[model samples]
Target: MISVSSISEFVYCPVKAFLNQTQKDNIQTREMIHGKLVREIRRGYEEITKQNMWSIKENIELEYIFSTIFEEVTPFIKKVSKKYSDKYEMDYSVLKDICNDLEDDLKLESQFLSLKVKKILNTTSKRGNEIAEMFFPQSLLEFPLKNEELNLRGKIDKIEVVNGVYYPVEVKTGMPPSKGVWLADALQIAAYVVLMDYELNKEVLVGFVDYIKICERRPVVVNSILHNKLFGVLDDMLTMFEKQEIPEFKLNKNKCEKCEYMDICEYYG
Candidate 1:
């Protein structure tokens, strides 16, 4: 099965997705490790916030909300940082330093989230409890979905149900572009919509890319244009996979500069 995420990877760099699947050895880099730790920390914060949402008073201050969430996530950072440090053979001290940096980053994220919460409550005509339920609709985290007909499968970061409609939400760890989402991200969301359609047996007209770094949700319309583009990429992905041949692509100096498969791609050349 072609993983949904590889669709985005392939869009970013054709060879990247190929190498990701073929490379069996587990190699860890500082950036990769740091990224993993950051994501874990953010997930911890999100889980805590969701768990405590209803319990929080409607009149709660944004700072109070942020502080509460941050406090709950503190131990999570330590636990995961230690786990990754040992597994990757990195110094625990270095990971601690990274965690220190993350403290600032996560603080900013929580603030953004808190502000969003406030905006929703203040602007909406519904009661505070109704606003809470609407803003944080019933959602499933890391929901597994698949389309056997398309031979595509992956987990949506969150599946939110609103007014009897299900929307797929893809959480992105990286910083978003200045304007809209990246092409890869948009396509990935469309791909998830396709999977949701298959799974739910109902047309999913929209999806979302949640840029967690800045706490922004960008909607993706699952229209014909996106469907055409998605199928085009799917064709290319399947062709490359079936032939077991690396497709020719101009090396992106910036991307290749930090790519884990640089050596392997160079070796192939």
Candidate 2:
């Protein structure tokens, strides 16, 4: 079964998808290296901050939220700190120092997280859309979705439920545009929309791209054109995988410049 992420890599560059999927050995790309850092920085953001979302909606003070989070998540953080320390071969003291910095910063970070959630429910012109009242989509996190017929499967970042209607939401730690999301990024959310339509039994017309860093949730217009593009990519991937055939390289200098496989890519042209 192909994941939404695998499909995303394909969209970035077919060879990137090919190398990642077909290679048996570990090929650490720039993305894989940085992905760890991103995950480490967000250690307690979603898992812990999400627990306080209700209080945030109730107009709870930021100070109160900050204190409550440390009180509640200390034990969890300690356990995680142990694992992270062992993996990185660092002393527990080193991990604790990093955690302290996170503690100092989370006061402001928590507010950004809450603001992103609010912008989603309360429509804004961030994405050039207009509305009076909030859409109030119930935030569903780490939801698993699969479409067997389409051979599509992945764990979704979030599924926003609005008036019993569901929409796929893909959150990013990276910076976002003042408008629409990137094509590769949009395609990932579009895949989730497809899975939500079939697996969740919800007719979702559109979805969102929650740029967590900037606290902006850009709406993704998932129409037939975008949906067809997603399927077309998937079909190509299926054929490549089934026939054990590697796809031809599409040389776009900008993409290859930052690719993890740049040094090792034999098809560089």
* Ten-residue stretch with the least lDDT total in model 1: 123-132
State residue 25's C-alpha deviation in candidate 2, in Å: 8.8
Error of 2 at 29 (Å): 5.9
lDDT of 2 by residue, 133-186 (tens): 133346777788888887778878777666777778886766676678988888
Q: Write candidate 1's Cα lDDT for 1-269 as tens digits.
A: 88888888898788878866556246555666676777777768666666655566565677776675456666777788778877888887787788887877777766776787777656654444554575578888788889888889898788889878888888887889998889899899898888877887757888888886676889888899989999999999999999998788877788887665666675333
**Lowest lDDT block of 10, candidate 2:** 124-133
